[model samples]
Target: MDIQPTSGSAGQTGGFAAGGAPSSGGGLINSDFETFLMMLTAQMKHQDPLNPVDSTQFATQLATFSSVEQQVRTNELLTALGAQMGALSVSQLSGWVGMIARAEMPVHFDGQPVTISTRAADLADRAELVVRDESGTEIQRLPIDPGRQELDWAGVSDSGAPLPAGIYELSVDSYAVDELIASDGVFVHARIVEARNENGRPILVMESGQEVAAGDIVGLRQAQ
Candidate 1:
């Protein structure tokens, strides 16, 4: 891929100036560095015969310039590395399209339901799953256990009637007491139906029609 150098960048070195069109007369070093070099060189050349320039001070200035240059080079390398890594990550995540992934999200009590594989402390009292429709409206509430439980919503409403197939969310609530906090809630294991980018960030489109960022992926598996 051809990467056109961004505008107002080439001439600006270390936040120096805004770059316009390219010029051949000017050297690589900006006016500031050039002026510093000229002043230092002139001072050394015009030093008095008796009180000459200090060799140690000159060495220190040279060392400072060298260090600054190295730092600039290091920063450029890091920026390049970051851009390359971002591209690679986006490309690799695209392979997850059409696959099922377990992503961690705040989609609590959405339409999706939760499933527990094993029993845990206070499974009966704590197990609760809530489902929601696309508009974030609560649909139904169901009780669950810490053990293997599938809180599947059969695309039905609270009146036990079939609803249109669309995106939904699930949230898990495993509270101990009436006024207590809990963590065991239903999670989503949605199939990634599509892969796309949102605001330059990679995202996965779940079969439930929910879009999730690639960074939100907690687990991944092949489509089955």
Candidate 2:
């Protein structure tokens, strides 16, 4: 799979700073507001008696500093949010290893089935679910509900037999009002075989041997 490598991954191209840092290359050394205040105070104290520092110039400088400070604060907040999101994703995905996830797929359900959910296109008259094993053999096929909001699967065989309860991905193809839509289904029930740090971010390795970042998941649950 072609993936854009992030700094936390081993093969990533560049790195990212987790938190705030001084600007690279020679630039402003001190906080802009502090610098402005210091300069303004010096000017006031050393100004010619007849020509004091202009009020308009001081106000402009202060305003500039205020804007710069706000920008710095905003950048810091965004970085923190990103880190928090990554943590949440890892926690959520970790829960799905032994649980059943609802996603769209062509896999069939034989006995008591585990249900997965996926959105079908409005124009889809019929959708197909294709299930493949580790050897990449087509094991099952199921029709989809064109009108219903979601599709369900119990991870069964085409003959309605119970297959081994494990990770099975799905691929969807639907036609709605003569328009075609194709969607990819992921098995959220796989165990996290490994945790990899790429480009300063975390990637979860699924038991199915799929690699995905924490941000890729939408939901998690115990498999029935």
Candidate 2's C-alpha runs over 4 A off are 1-33, 45-52, 102-204, 212-224
Each model's number of backbone clashes? 10, 32
* Candidate 2: tens digits of C-alpha lDDT, residues 49-87: 454445565555556556656676777778789888777
Which segments of candidate 1 are over 4 A away from where they belong? 1-35, 48-50, 105-124, 132-139, 161-169, 177-179, 193-202, 207-209
TM of each candidate vs. truth: 0.63, 0.44
Clashing pairs in 1: 109-171, 110-132, 110-169, 110-170, 111-168, 111-169, 112-169, 112-170, 172-185, 172-186
Q: How do the residues 64-94 of candidate 1 rate in per-residue lDDT, one tens digit apiece?
A: 6555555666777787787777677778877
- Please report how far candidate 2 places residue 122 from its true position, in Å: 7.5
lDDT leader: 1
